[model samples]
Target chain A: MSLHLQPVRVATSSDDSESQLVFAEGFLVAMLVHLSEQHEDDAGRWFLEAGFGRIPSRDHPTFLDLDEAQTWIRQQLGNAYVS
Target chain B: MASNFTHPLFPLIRKLDSIATLTDEERQAVENLPVRIRALRARHEIVRHGEKASQCCLILEGWACRSKVISEGKRQIFSFHIAGDIPDLQSLHIPLMDHDLCTLTQATVAFIPHEAVRDLTMRFPSIAAVFWRDTLVDAAIFREWMISMGRRTAFDHLAHLFCELYLKQQAVGLAGEHRCPLPITQGDLADATSLSNVHVNRVLKEMRGKGLITLRSNTLVIEAWDELIRAAEFDATYLHLQKRAVP
Candidate 1:
C-alpha cells in the first residue's frame, strides 16, 4: 500500500503548528506535527501527533524526517494486514 | 548530617509530627529504635517488586518514588517522596513488595527493622494510631491521584500534583514561599501523570507562557499560586495535615 502525506497545520495550543496528514491508500492514517524550537534538543523533528487504525496511540514517537515516519506507519499498517 | 544531630531518627519524628502530635515518650522510643543509614546515588532501587523485605526505608534526605514498570519497560511513578517519608512503610506489615521504590536523587536513607517498628507500635498504641492515620492519609492522596489520572486534563493534573508536592514539602519544612525543589525531570512528570513526554513539554511551555510557573535548574517556582490552584481546582483536604502549611 502506498502512503501519501499532505502538509497541514495543527492547532496544538503550542508552538508546534506545522503538521502533515498521512494517508494509506487514500485513507487518512496519521497526523504528524513538526517539533517547534520549544522542544530544544528535539526541535525540527517530526512527532506523531495522532494515529488512527493500526497506528498505536500510546506511543507518540518522534522521527528525524517524514521518510522515517512513513516507514513506521507502513510497518504498522503491514502488521495490521499480516495479522 | 547536622553537627548537633542528637539522633538519626529525627527525620522520622519530624515527619510524624507534621501530621500528628508525638508524645515525648514516643519520640524517645523512635530515637531509640535501631537503624542502618546508607547513602545512595540517584535511581538506586531500595526495594524491588515481589521482594520480601525485612525492613522499611525512610528518606532522610533527597527524594524517592514508588513506581512500577509495565510492558515495553514503561514506568509509572505512583508517588514522589521527600525527607521523612517511609515510601516502603507497608513492608513493615506486608513483607512481600508489590511495587518498586527507588531514589530520584542522591539520598541518605535509614532502614528500620520490621521487628523494631512492630514492637514500637505494640508498646505505644497512640503511635500505632498515628501510623494508621498516616496510611489513611496516604490512601486519601491515592484517591485524589485517581481523580487526576482518570478525569483531570493533563494541565490540571500536573498543576494539582505540583500543589500537592509543594504543600507536602512545606509541611515538612523542606519548602516555603510557593517555591519547592522539583528535582525530577519532565520524563518523570510524564510517567507520574500518564502523559507523553511531548505532551508534558507542551503543557509546561503553555504554563510558562501564561506566567503561571517557572521550572528551571530542578527548582519549581509558582509564579501565581492562586491562579494555578484555581486552574487545577486543587483542594488540599486530601492531604490531611494537622497543621496546614503556608501556600
Candidate 2:
C-alpha cells in the first residue's frame, strides 16, 4: 500500500550495464557511446545465443575480468568527475 | 572442539586466516563459534522474506538459489549458493529480507548467529574486513548477474553460470578441470536466466549440440573448457579464493 523507501543507492534495474555508475559524471558519455553503437544490434544477441541473458554487451565493450571492469568503471567516474 | 574445520568453505574462510598466529585460546575461540546445521532437500526456502534478519547461514554443501519475487509470480534469482557460500551474509544491515533465499537441492548449512559474528569481529577486526569483502564480492556477483540478465543473450548467461560454478566450486576444493557436478534443473536455470524454461532447454540442447559441454545426469563434463570459458567470458578475479594450502 505504502512505500518503504530508504536512503539506499539504487542501481539500474534495466537491461543495461551502464546503469551501475550512470549518475556520477562522464560515465554518461561512455554509456552513450556504449549503448548506441554496440548493444543496439546483433552484438547483444550473441550473449542470448550463448544462453546467458541480461548483460549489456555494448556497455561493457570488452569481456574483461571483474577487477579490470571495476578499474574501467572508476576511470569513467574519475575522468568524468575530474574534468 | 576440534580446530580442524572439516567444512567445505574452510578453504575459502581459511584464505582469510590472517589470525592463524593467534594464541591457542584465541584460535579455539574463533573456531568454536556455535554452528547450527541444517539440511535441505531440493527446491526448499532456506529463509523467506518478511522475517527479521537473524543468524547468517553459511552454506556448507549442495546448491541453493537466492531470488526476488516480482509481479506476475515471476522470480529473479540473484545468485546460486554452492559449497562455502554464506548466502545470508548480506543480512548484516537489512532489517528484513527484500528477497527470498531458497535451496535448489539437498543442502547443508551452518547458522552463525549475528551476535556471535559481531562479537567475533570485535575481537578480530580482520574478520569484519574479510566478511565485508565477502559480502562485497557477493554484491559484485549480483551486479555481474544483473548485467547478464539485463543485457546478454541466453547462451552467454548459461556459459557464464557454468564457468562461474566450476570456478567457485573449485575454490572450495569441490571441482576440477573436466567434470563438475552441479545439482541444478532447467526450471531453476530458467528462473535464474530470466528466460522461459523452454528457451533454456532449447539453448542447452544447442550448447551440447555444438560440443561445448556434455550434460549427463546432474553433473556437467566440460569437454572443451577453454571454449566454454571463452564462450562465457569467465574470469576468476571475482572469486578471490586462493587459500595457501596448510603446511
Candidate 3:
C-alpha cells in the first residue's frame, strides 16, 4: 500500500512553548502501529509507541535512531513520502 | 417483467446465480416453491438453539445473524445475512439448530418447508448441487473467520470482514463503489470480533482518523480500498463468486 504524508502546520501552546511540532497526514497510522512489534535485544526488551492519525507521534523508546527511523518511515510510505 | 417482490424465490435465484447457473426449468421450479412469508421485528429469534426446525428462513429484506450465547450471556456472532440469504438452510439437513438465528432489523422472511426443498432437490439434481455448494461456501467462510479470530489482530479481522461483506453484497448488486449498508452496532462488532466494545470504538476512531473508512448511520464507505485490502490481507477467492465483476 502507498501512504502519502503531507505536512500540516498547527500552532499550540505547551510546556515547551519554544518547541515547534510538525504533524504529517496521509500515513496509514493504525496499520503501521499494528504492524510494529516490540523487540528484545542485548539492551533488553524495548516498547515502541507509534501514534495514529495524519502525523506520526512516538513517545516510547525506539531501536532505530533518527536517520534509521526516517528511512523506515519512508520505506513504509513507499513513493508517497514527500521529504 | 414483474417486480422481484412478486416472486418470493427471486432472492434465492439471485444468490444462487452468484455461485452457479440454473436452467430455465430449474428457475421455474424455484419460482414455484411454496413459502410462508412472515414479517418479523428486530431482535426476534427465528430459530432458537436446540430447537428442531421444519423450515428454512430466507431473508427477503433486512439483516439477520447467526449467533450462540455462551456463559455470562456473552454472544458470539457467527455470520450476518442480507436479502436473498437463507440463514438457516443447514436446518434442512441438520434438523436441530445448534445456534440461534435472529433478525438484526425489521425483516421480511420467506419460510420454505423442508419437504418442498427436498422435493425440488430430488427432482433437479443440478439444483441440489448448487445448494450443496452454497453450504460448502458457508463452511469456507466459517474457516476464514476462525483464522481471523486466531491469527489476526482486531484491526485486520475487522478490515477483512468489511471486505468480505462488501464483496458479498456487490455480488448480489446490493453494494458498489466501496460503500454498503452495514446496519450493525459497535457492540455487535465487538461480539463478532471477540473484542471489547471500548476496543472496537478505539479502533473505529483510529480507522476514521486515518481516513481508511467512513462508517455512519448504518452505512460504511471504504475511503482507501487498496489500503484496506492490504491491511486486511484480503482475497475474494474464499467467497467463490461466479460473476466477480463489480456492476
Candidate 4:
C-alpha cells in the first residue's frame, strides 16, 4: 500500500516546525519535521518526530527528503503487518 | 616534603580535598603513592567491560567517561570525568570492570595499583572514609541522572548537567565566573542524557537563543546562571562538595 503525506506545521517549540503527517491505509502512521537552519549541516533534512504502531520511539531517524522518509515508513509498516 | 608535595599526583589530593579536609599526612601519603603515568589519545579505552583491572586510572589532564555499549552500537555514557577524577576507582575493590572507561580528549592519566590503594586505605581509615564518601556522592549523582532521564524535560536535564559540570570544575579551581571547559561533543551529550543528537542540537540552540549559555571553542559560558538554575530547579546539595565552589 502506498503512503499518503499531508504537509502540515508542527509546533516543535523550535525553528524546525515545518512538518508532514503520513497516512498508511487512512491510519496516521507518523509525523516528520523539517530541520531548520539552526541545525547547520542537518538543516533541510526530515526527522521522524513521532511514529506509532510498532514504529518504536527510540528510532529517531533523519532522512534526506520526504520520499526517503515515506519509503522508510512503508518498510516499517510493512514489517509490522508481516510480523 | 614541600618539593615532594608538588607531585604529579597532586590532582588526586586536590580532588579529595575538594570533598573533605585532608590532613598533611594524608596529603603526603597520597603524594607519595607510586603511579605509572601515561599519555593517552582521545577515545582510547582504559578499562574494558568484564576486564579484570589491576589498577585504577586517575585523570591528570583533559576528560574521560564511563560508558557501556548495548546492541547496535548504542552507547550510554554513565558519567563525564575531568582532571583529578578516578573514573574507575570502584575497580580497586571490584577488580572486574562493569563498564568501559575511556578518555574523551587527549589526556594524561596515572595508573595506581590496586594493592597500593588497598594498603593505603587499610593503614589510613580516614582516607578510606573519604573514598567511601566519594562513592556515595557518585551514587547521588546517579540518582540525579535517573530523575533527569525519567522525569525532567530535555531542556531542564541539559541545564542541570551544565550546572553540575561547572560547579564540579569550580570546586577544583579549574573554572570560575560561570565559565567552564565543555570539550565534549554534542553526540556525547546525547549519550549521557539519553536523548537523540537532533534533540540535543535543538536544545542547545534553544539554550543559545534564550541567552542561557554560549558554547564556543570548547568552552561553555553560563550567561544566565541564576535563570538557568531556576529553570532547571538544580539543587547543588546533592553534589555534596564539602567545600562548595564559589559560583
Q: Please provide, for model 2 over B1-247, each residue's C-alpha lDDT reduced to its tens digit, 9 standing for 90 to 100.
A: 2435764445335434531233455456656788777777877887788888778887777787888887657778878887666788778677488788888888887788888878887887656666687777787787888878887778888888888888776665677876888788777888888875545665677688789888888898888889987888877676666542221
Which runs in model 1 stand beyond 4 Å of their true positions? A79-83, B1-6, B243-247
Kindly list the per-residue Cα lDDT of model 3 for residues B117-186, writing each as its tens digit: 9999999887788788778889999999999989998789989999999998999989999999999888
- Residue-level lDDT tens digits of model 1 in A1-83: 78888999889889999999998877888999999998998999999989988898778889999999999899889945422
Worst 10 residues of 4 chain A by lDDT: A74-83
Give Cα distance to truth, residue B237, candidate 2, Å: 2.8
Model 1: per-residue Cα lDDT over B1-247, one tens digit each: 2421567777788887776676778788888889999999999999999999999898999999999999989999999999888888888888899999999999999999999999999998877877787777889999999999999998999999999999998998889999999999999999999998889999999999999999999999999999999999999999987653221
- Cα RMSD to native, each candidate? 3.1, 14.6, 14.0, 2.8
Better of 3 and 4 by TM-score: 4
- The TM-score, computed over Cα atoms with residue i paired to residue i, of candidate 4 is 0.95
lDDT of 3 at B89: 89
lDDT (CA) per prediction:
0.89, 0.63, 0.74, 0.89
Ranking by lDDT: 4, 1, 3, 2
Q: Which residues of candidate 2, in runs, are more than 4 Å off? A: A1-83, B1-27, B242-247
- By TM-score, the candidates rank as 4, 1, 3, 2
Could you tell me the lDDT of residue B42 within candidate 4?
Answer: 97
Candidate 1: Cα lDDT at B168: 94
lDDT minimum window of 10 residues, candidate 1 chain B: B1-10
What CAPRI-style quality would you assign to candidate 4?
A: medium
